[model samples]
Target: MVAEEAEVLVVGAGLAGLRCAGVVAAAGRDVRVWEAGDEVGGRIRTDVVDGFRCDRGFQVLNPAYPELARSVDIANLRLQHFGAGVGVRREDDAVILAHPLRRPTRVPGMLAKRAVRPSDVVALVRWAYPALRPSALTANTGGDTTLLAALDDAGLRGELRRVVDRFLAGVLLDDGGSTSNAFALLLVRMFALGVPALPAAGMQALPRQLAGRLGDRVSTTRRVVEVSRDSAGWRVTAEDGAVARARHVVVATDTRAAAALAGTDPVPTHGVVTDWWASDREWPGPPMLFVDGRSGSRGPVVNTAVISAAAPTYAPAGRHLVQASALWGPGRPEPAETQMRAHAAEILGVDAGGWQPVIRHVVRDALPAQPPPLRTRRPNRAGAGLWVCGDHRDTASIQGALVSGRRTGAAVLRALG
Candidate 1:
């Protein structure tokens, strides 16, 4: 078969690959992208199950992502925002700790329940205030430590501390608090600045919009089996014997695949299992995330939410969508169906046994591990004409993926010139 030719070739049509293609294409370069999956959106995919839109895993699109404005139309996605608060399940009842600015009405209740103590508030501010600065995420100038140590050092061993820990477990997929404190604080800053939301269509809408920008440049189901350097730059061989030759190649696949194709060390990863359920009963709770905050209680389910309450489009008329997530990886056995339901029931203060199970997504590589000594910019160039980009190369978030893709694209352009 005749080999395809392009000035730049991007493997994997995830947010990173698609964004890189956009950058190169915008620069008048002939760029092409190949995706191994049957459709775009890589890890950020959604499936319709009995009229419910079940995303591969629990995820949210934060409008505060700085790169989002430069890449996709957030307004066009018609985002349905979650309430600026989190419901914490205690031993007796569920309480909420809300954003002070956005949910001022909830503040009085939070204070009444002692969910936000003065000491805890001061400690949290001391720990996370630096990340609110513009240069905190862009430059790694601060001292680094595990999240636990940072919180403890800042004297945040209160009820609010437990709430932050449980909430971050669902977001970072790291229940151990071993992730970099800086990275975690940066995420908190983003959450404070912008409300996390779901598009009316689904989380996949984000990547779908990016893929649509590239038109036919993205070819799905063309899994590249190998990437090798050639006299002309590099060659990518797909599983079905199709070949693509390019002057520059970017391995923008997931962490494991990128490591294999680019011959780089595979970074550690964390996984999460998310189960979606459909219920006939209306959601009785607010449209926000619910976390297990029973003091020192490490339940099987980290977090869960009445997803349809926040975004009605996720469910069909008269039905509701709910999702529960648990940390899944080494030493962390997947929770049993009974345990997941029980924990979710406790968190939401609702009977979950009658909810119909829609689907369970075991995203084993949900996110690349973000360890301490946060290095926002890892080397993207693997060799002369070889490069790599993904959340693995930067922070483990949508913002990281898009920024890494754009950064790699510019590097390739400079090299080509």
Candidate 2:
């Protein structure tokens, strides 16, 4: 049949695509977003089952996310901050890293109680350098360079591998090997900007708000089959034989999808598994915990969060919710659910026997595994009238996705002008 026409055709209704559509439409341009799933948010999805609200994966927002805080109205959304310092659980020891906001008197006690070795604390302080300086941290090459190389020297490597890497792996879900040293610096920048924030309702609320703001410009359940250029502009064919033509098009899906639509082959993307537990305990609140699970018996379990305490609406009153995640190496066998429960129980200091986790989510292609001096990132513009945007294009995170979308949108706008 005939193809629909618009000034801009955005594929993927995730945060990036929706954001692009919103910005373009707000600028008085005709923009339409095509979403493959029946829902709007891509990976950032939430489900309500049996009076419980659960996100596909536990996600948090750093107040420092430039795109979200600056472009989107986050204040209107329900948000809660994790207290300053993150809590850590290693074997029998449980400790809380106090945020700088704590009273000076309490800071020492908290650190001491948490059993934070003086050297570990010192290493943490040193690592905070790049984060404190916005200009230095955001430098284009800052994220691409290796942290090890930047701090190449004696003692530092030992400290990083022993203390810093362990802690970071617990938080970021991947060892520093899969990410850039700049990525760590960015987290520090986020902490320096403001505490990590979570939506009171659920993670999906953020994307839903963005989609709602876009009005009738979004089309859900429209899977994009192909993206190619024609003499007039760009032609985007959906799975159902429907076509959309636009002067500009943005592919904002995940990396695999983006590659497929652009007629490129798929590359290896490291996978990770996340488990969410909801029960009767009180969630300890945000600054959620990040344990250095590298030393644990079960293998590398990084980046665990106590989400319910971070936000009130995640669970029913008096009930707590916790999300524990771990990244598996390529070709590694998936861990059994029983094993995950045991690990969670040991980490959280609770008897997980009766506390059933309602949700289990596994992202086989969570994010790309980029080594230091990260490579494999594609450009935003694939052709004259077509563009690409997603977390995979740069750093891997919600903020990265938003920034990529904004950048692609700006580029498309400029090209049109």
Candidate 3:
């Protein structure tokens, strides 16, 4: 029996689902969004503790994504900007190297560390010049090679290579050696060209803003248990025995969930764990990212930062919010809470022994594996009137999620017309 009819039904009210629904709704079509959880924003969630806003895991928004402006309100996000460079701790020394364009003053610091020698600087310019061409920056130079091989082809070695490998180990949550060269290059381009920021309230502000536009149209606690084709077009059933029928149904859930609901093989993914703590240390310079070169760090933390530096609102009036993260796999070391703080201290040379540990989040399917030969835009249509869209269908970032939504929405629109 048909429970209700919708012009378009979006399963999962994450960024992808919200984006797809927003697009269809803007065209004056009836759209409904069903979210299983008590709230929207999926992995992008923020918790308010004792008047301080702490994100579940450390994440940033990149303004360099071309699709962002078309999908969401830029000014309303009220983003908080992070410094344009990374601080590397190699052995006993700690040094910073900012992007020349973003932190001209810190260029000398990059040079001081020899992260990029004078000749390497010229090569770097040659490497980055193509980003000026909008088409060149947007186009994908297809490749099925590993990122390490791409670095070799680009002639990026020495300190540049060292820091990049170290940095990406944290970002990609892998050794950075096995990632797709094409995807890695795209990520590099985004990093070099984009401004990283966080929403004033927290990362959740982004999805919450999008969900607010739908008002009552987005329903939480309605877990979609099954997806099937019907005479009407498609049928999505909730665990509670309710149903939503529509001419087109988009499964915008995560890769694993989507695969399960669609009866497809689950994709490989990377698990990540992060711990947040409160510290009372002196200023650690700018709100820049800190990476461990693995030159002899004594802990599992590969990257850490006082995120409150990037966004003052993240912490209450005078408290500093610290976050540390690492990629997880077999043989991975997960030190206890105290050890994590000590490890962070060893990397930053800050004594965090007195800092208070607040929260720790572990996501088993945090990021979908992006191997070489990536199809940035995967086919969204599962069958007639059935579709799927998520970060797994594209690059593993907010850009990918929104882009998938846009593409799915466009495909649905063309089909209906």
Candidate 4:
């Protein structure tokens, strides 16, 4: 095998790449990362406007993100927790799903409301049991079933579907049919850990902090044009004709980008558009809401949240920030902004006509459509010295991305040793 120069080279500067770079660099290996964009953080993007901090889309840190918490010093960041009760808006009436932290005994009362049917409550109880049981819930077993399939009764299925769709709009980013039951259960488990929290500065703070830690080891705007293997290692050609040979190469971009770079037959992946808004009014409460089972004039709008509403730092004093996201299925037609605004106003009670959202951004490929078995995923190790890491390769979420990156880094370190 032709020997390569550097110990490791990581592609993409998203969460996965950052984690991989941090690990390999800390291990004293010669690690370098190439990012296509001018900045890192990949999909975990945040923007600040008019004193309001808005994320590319609404993002919540699962207090249960084990690898993320361990890898980074998140406690030092300005983080705030969600309110004890999460509101569910359906047919314009708000139903509260109170967390255990707020009112321990009132959970039963909240569950008994008309918004959540008795059957739905029973299904929740059954589902919660396995999660509560030790050894049943773990990383590997998280995405095993679809949320709809887990419930035995039709009534329970319908109720929970509405509750989840309307309240936790962005939770799955998939239609009811496509969402995994196990993943939904895992989200419920996150609720037990702590309501979703946000960093004081913004979501981008997390990635910026990670990049800062890596220092000069990371490079930006260096698009990797092609990746080919040599006898000993791999050869990575940049768009500018610059070449880098490495003992190991980690592809940590999204599945689509990774497939493109690796020359694999691209698979069909769904795309989404996320719009962020900054408002002057203080959000009535925390921004975590579920918008399920509501009939909209423009068909079904999946999930919506007020990110800045969840914490004071997200927006300037007396102002709040909101992110409304719509997941378009593969081949699904894109809805107009007017349609989205109308739906958001109707479901979220935000006066779309009156409120002028200060900052707006859209993501074409928000996340891959997560189907059961996640067959389109590529293994972390692709070839002799080429490795892959991304949320799509494992569970499709922030935690999954971190885990994949850490595992790939470990594997490369071992192979080099």
> Model 4 — TM-score against the truth?
0.88
lDDT score for residue 1 of model 2: 92
lDDT agreement with native, every candidate? 0.89, 0.70, 0.79, 0.70
Write the number of the candidate with greater TM-score, choosing between 1 and 2.
1
Q: Name the runs in model 1 displaced over 4 angstroms.
A: 101-109, 134-142
The residue-by-residue lDDT of candidate 1 on 1-417, one tens digit each, is: 999999999999999999998999999999999999999998999999888999998999999999999999989999999989788888888887886545557666866867678777778778877776747554653677899898889998767888888899899999788999888888888887899999999999999999998999989999999998878778899999999999899999988898889998889999999888889997777999999888766568989999999999999999999899999999989988778878898889998867988999999999999988888889999998899999999899999999999999999889979
lDDT of 2 by residue, 1-417 (tens): 999999999999887788777778777888999999998989888887655677775566776677777557787776788777665665566666565433235557756664555665455556566566656554565346665554442234432344456565544656644566666676656766677777766778788888998888888889999888888988999999999998988888887898888654454566777787777865443446655433535543555666767677777777777677777666567777777777766666667767776878777776655555543235788877878887777667777778777778877888878
Candidate 3 residue pairs in backbone clash = none
Give per-residue CA lDDT, model 3, range 212-320, as digits (tens): 8888889999999999987768888999888989898899998888988876556788877888987776556678888775443457776888888888898887788
- Candidate 4, residues 1-417: lDDT per residue as tens digits? 342257798999999899988888888889989998888899987777778777775677866777778778878667887765556565657666665433557766866666566666665576665656434544445445655565543345664555554444366666655565555556666677666788888788888888898898888898998888877678888886678898888988877788877754443454567666666765565556545455443444566667666777877777666666677655667676666667766667667655566655556666655655433234677778888888877667788788888888888889889
What is the TM-score of candidate 1?
A: 0.97
What is the TM-score of each predicted model, taking all chains together?
0.97, 0.88, 0.92, 0.88
- The residue pairs found clashing in candidate 1 are none
Which candidate number maximizes lDDT? 1
Best by TM-score: 1
- Candidate 3 shows a clash count of 0
Candidate 1 residue 353 C-alpha distance from true site, Å: 2.9
